[model samples]
Target: MSTDTDTPGGDADTAARSLAHWSEAGRAEMEAFYALATEDYRQLALAADWPTVLRAVTHDGWRVLDVACGSGKFPTALDRYTDLSALPEASYDLLDPSTFSIAEARAQLRPPFSAAREFAVTLQELPADAGPYDVVWATHALYALPPAELAQGAEQFVRALRPGGLGFVAQATAQSHYLAFYDAFRAGVRDRTPYTSAEQVADALRAAGGDVRTQTVEYTSGTADRAVAEGFLQRCAFDDAVSLDQMEAAPVLGDYLAGCRDASGAYTFQHEVMLIWL
Candidate 1:
């Protein structure tokens, strides 16, 4: 959800391509991406008792900001895997650089997540007077955020929180599937910097003066369908132009994908995500 446009030190051409893919024209790519990526949200939903977590930070009129919210998958996952019927209604603000994503995420809101404000801006561009929210979260949403801007972005994130409020972020570490695979993709298929890592995020938050606590969640999502695997991998690289066969033939990426393939030829992606609380 954190588009590279506003991220300093990001690749402009790559950022433009990534930004274009989030539009209506790219719906197919989005769907294909979500086919396997939905597991990412489901896994996070099961990571904790979210209702309790929300209740712990809720107040009479508490508000929540979903940073770089992508199709509102986190709240949708909460609705699917947990009950939020008893919680007090809270205003939910959506923030993302993509208008399509903002609309998609807004449509997914339910009770206890009454849709309120919509911010069509990158994290670095978030208005200074925007929020003092009781809950702020970004679920696997900061991958495109440039390393140079992580500290500033983290500062804005921490600044948005109200006193005694809760802040949460979920991201893949350097060795996780998302990060590792992207590294290989850049090496074999493209030439780009690695995606931001969870460790970097935690350090940035700490630099912003946040007292961060972390939990690790490990899981695997696999598919025997080659189409699904291809779509998943293509989405992972944000390059639908590349075919599965091409990926399987690349030097570094080919070896990486082969390592993930089992005897049945199913591709299994291993994920290790960090759940950070501040």
Candidate 2:
């Protein structure tokens, strides 16, 4: 039932396996990049909102489903909220298209739930009778969804949630680093597929009949080395085989990187993310 959540197959596959670029070394490099970049982010406390959202929708224990749960970071961030050990008999359902991600999330997530299940699939592929969850969420994982399917995915979110169930999703805004960089990448590198944006998702969700709310926050990330910046961009584009030199050689990519560089020669990326809820 999934639309385009494959691990970067071919022309038939509309989405790339984004996590493919996130190997151990790449993850380390990204952490280094983030250390230098996210200090000024307004919504630094992104995970703290989960419990608040969970409480607003249902006072009962959570039957939580994390869509595209990558590396279990969202569950890790839950520490800022209530202790997972103290919550009663909660249930966790992990949904993702990556076996690697599902495994990592399972090993890393220490949810307070007494029972947990993992679905190695996308939201669109989830079974019709998976039960209306108390809370269903997709964090930064919707990037791979094709533009045409955004509305269908939004409807899936609504269908997954039970009565009064709450849902939360965080995504990079249209003007954010991810979208902007990809816009430049697609224009200059390859124009095969379009990037899915939070604005588009919000509009589609609202049109699908949900009471959607959005909040934006700013953040910055930087690096002093061009090579480091290039590596980050390559990973973002899910093409590690391509060197930074090649990227710079491309007219559009090279120009985009040039604009992102500052007087100090450090590469800085400014991002605005939207916290969407209903």
Candidate 3:
């Protein structure tokens, strides 16, 4: 749910800012994300596999701690894989840096996971003794963490999980849309922070002493609507202040967008995802 790419957040002031400011960008990104993600998922049968894995590896009962539990999409996906009656003792804990997102997570974390405890803090801010969870999960939440913070966040997840517990993370590859667009954004416009690639995250997990496994999934997201395409890139860069018109006028952005266009003139984004877990 973390909208910020593996983008390195600035000093404390930026970290402390309310996420309400990002709603416009988030909404803009989600619209484009939903349209393309659905098409890709259907084509590849790329459903989330977390809940199935959880059901297979659990004991009598367990607890789950979802870091940056972005609007609870994972929990919703979990319901599709199992019933509430099957895991009566299962408890959920939600953690996110956004206060606004905490409320959204509460609203969307259906049935079994709705009763979760909430933690409104970044992974780097999460206390070391905060958990002994059966599962520690971070979805698209870790994009904006700086290198050092990214390392700390990964260590926190490894430490948060109990012995024999599982840790899962889903993030974009270096060539993925989120990463590539940001790369272009920086090159064409101002120098913004870079996204933390999935490889870096997997390495951090392994460094934490967890036996890590990985899989790469590829997909393409394309839309013919120029408005949607422009908005998606704006939001991907986390800069809602810039308009599509401005992006087009910029020499570098214009060249980059030109490259992203297909024969049909639809803006196409090539995405490669890395799914890692222990």
Which prediction has the highest TM-score against the true structure? 1
Question: After aligning candidate 3 to the native by TM-score, how far in Å is the CA of 34 from where it should be?
Answer: 4.2
Write the residue-wise lDDT of candidate 3 on 253-276 in tens digits. Answer: 777777878888878878888888
Model 3, residue 146: distance off in Å is 1.7
Indicate which candidate wins on lDDT.
Answer: 1
Clashes of each: 0, 2, 6
lDDT string, candidate 1, 26-145, tens digits: 888888878989999999999998888888988778899999897888999999999988899999999988999999999999998999998998788889888899999999999877
Q: What lDDT does each candidate get?
A: 0.87, 0.70, 0.69
What's the C-alpha lDDT at position 208 in model 2? 74
Off by over 4 Å in 1: 1-14
The TM-scores of all predictions, comma-separated, are 0.95, 0.83, 0.83
- Report the error of model 2 at residue 207, Å: 2.6
- Order of models, best lDDT first: 1, 2, 3
For residue 153, give model 3's deviation from the true position in Å. 1.1
